[model samples]
Target chain A: GESVGLHLPTLSVQEGDNSIINCAYSNSASDYFIWYKQESGKGPQFIIDIRSNMDKRQGQRVTVLLNKTVKHLSLQIAATQPGDSAVYFCAEKTAGGFKTIFGAGTRLFVKA
Target chain B: DVKVTQSSRYLVKRTGEKVFLECVQDMDHENMFWYRQDPGLGLRLIYFSYDVKMKEKGDIPEGYSVSREKKERFSLILESASTNQTSMYLCASSSDRGSGNEKLFFGSGTQLSVL
Candidate 1:
C-alpha cells in the first residue's frame, strides 16, 4: 500500500524556461532519493540523487531537492532543452535495503 | 560503461506457455534485479540476486521465478504466461551493501506480449 507518486502526470515547458517536477512518497524512513530520465523505448538513466542528510543535490543541469519532513521530492531542470524531453521518475531507496521504489513518472515535453 | 543486456528486445508468447527472460551484466556487480514496468505502476521488482545461487523476492514476485547460477547472469522464468504478464521487463545491476548509493544500471528492456 505504501507508494511513491508524482504530483503531475505530464508537464509542458518552453525550451529556454525552467521546469520543476514534484513527487510525493508515503515512506518517511527512506534515506536516499534518485531522479531518473527515461526516453521512449529506452531504459531509465540516472540523473541526480540526494541523500536524506542533504536537502538538495545538483548535477549537470538538474537538481534534486528532498524534503523528508513532508516526504516530498522534486527535480528541477534549468533552461530545459528539447533533449530534456522524457519521462522523469523519482525513486526512493528502501530503508536499510538496496531496493528502490519508483513513482509514476511525469512526462516532460520541452517545446522549442 | 556498465552494460546490462536482456536476451530479447521484444517477445510474444501464448497464454499458458512458459517464458524465460534472460539478463546478463558485464559489470561484476553483486546485485542483479528483475523488474516489470507498467503504466501508472512504475517499475515493480520481480526478483533480485545478491550472490550466485541466491535470490530474494521483490514486491511483485508472484507468477515469477528467478535463477542466478552465475554472477554475471540472472534469469526470470514465468511458469505460465498470462495476458497480465505482458509488459516491459528491465534488468538492472548494482553493487552489494556498503557500495554507497551506487545507481542501478538498467538494460534496454524486453517488451513482452502474452496472448
Candidate 2:
C-alpha cells in the first residue's frame, strides 16, 4: 500500500530562525502534494501545495519543494514565530484519485 | 467562507457502546471525508462519500461505517467502541472539480475518549 511518512517526529527552532520539515512518499503516481498545519485542538489547515509538474511553490512565509524522482517533499518556513508552533503534515494525492493520504505529522516548536 | 461543522467538540463513551459522529458542510461540496488522528499517526482516512448514498472505505475503516443520505452531511458510526478508538476525529469537504486537485476544507475536530 502507498503511504506518506515524515522524516522527523519533532523539530525545535529559534523564533527568528528558519525551519525545514521533510517527508517521503512511496507512491510514484501521486501528482499533487499539500502541506498542512495543525494547532492544538484543531483540525489540519492547508498551508501550501505543489503539483508534480512544478518543483517548488511559494506562499507567504512558507515554501514547498517536491522531488518526484526521489519521492521527497519538504516544507520550509522563514522567520519562524511562536505562532508557527504546530504539527505539520504532508499529504499526497494520486493521479485521478479522490482520496488523499496524509503522513504522520512533524511537530514544530518555535522557541523564543 | 466554507464551514465544516462537527456536532460535538468532545465526547466520552464506554466500551461496547455505539457512537455516532456527525459532520455538516455548508459549501455544498460533492465530497466529504472522516479521518482519525492519533498521537503518533497523523490522519488516517476512515471513510469518504462522493455523493449522496455513496460511501467508500478508506485506509483505516475497521470497526466503522458511514452514512451520507444527504449531500451536505456525512456521518461516522462506531458499532462497538473500544479504548483504542479514542482519538481526534476530523471531517473535511472538497469540491467536485478535478479528481485530485481538490483542496479540503476541514472542521475543528471532535475528540473522543472511549473508556
Off by over 4 Å in 2: none
Best by DockQ: 2
Query: What is the per-residue lDDT of model 1 for residues B4-69, given as tens digits with 9 covering 90 to 100?
Result: 999999999999999999999998999999999999879999998889999999999999999999
The TM-scores of all predictions, comma-separated, are 0.97, 0.97
Tens digit of per-residue lDDT, candidate 2, span B6-95: 999999999999999999999889999999998888899999999999999998899999999999999999999999999999999999
For residues A2-112, could you state the per-residue lDDT of candidate 1 as single tens digits? Answer: 689999999999999999999999987778888999999899998988888999888888988888889999999999999999999999885458788899899999999
* lDDT tens digits by residue: candidate 2, A44-94: 898999989999999999999998889999999999999999999999997
Instruction: Calculate DockQ per candidate and list them.
Output: 0.62, 0.76
Docking class of 1: medium
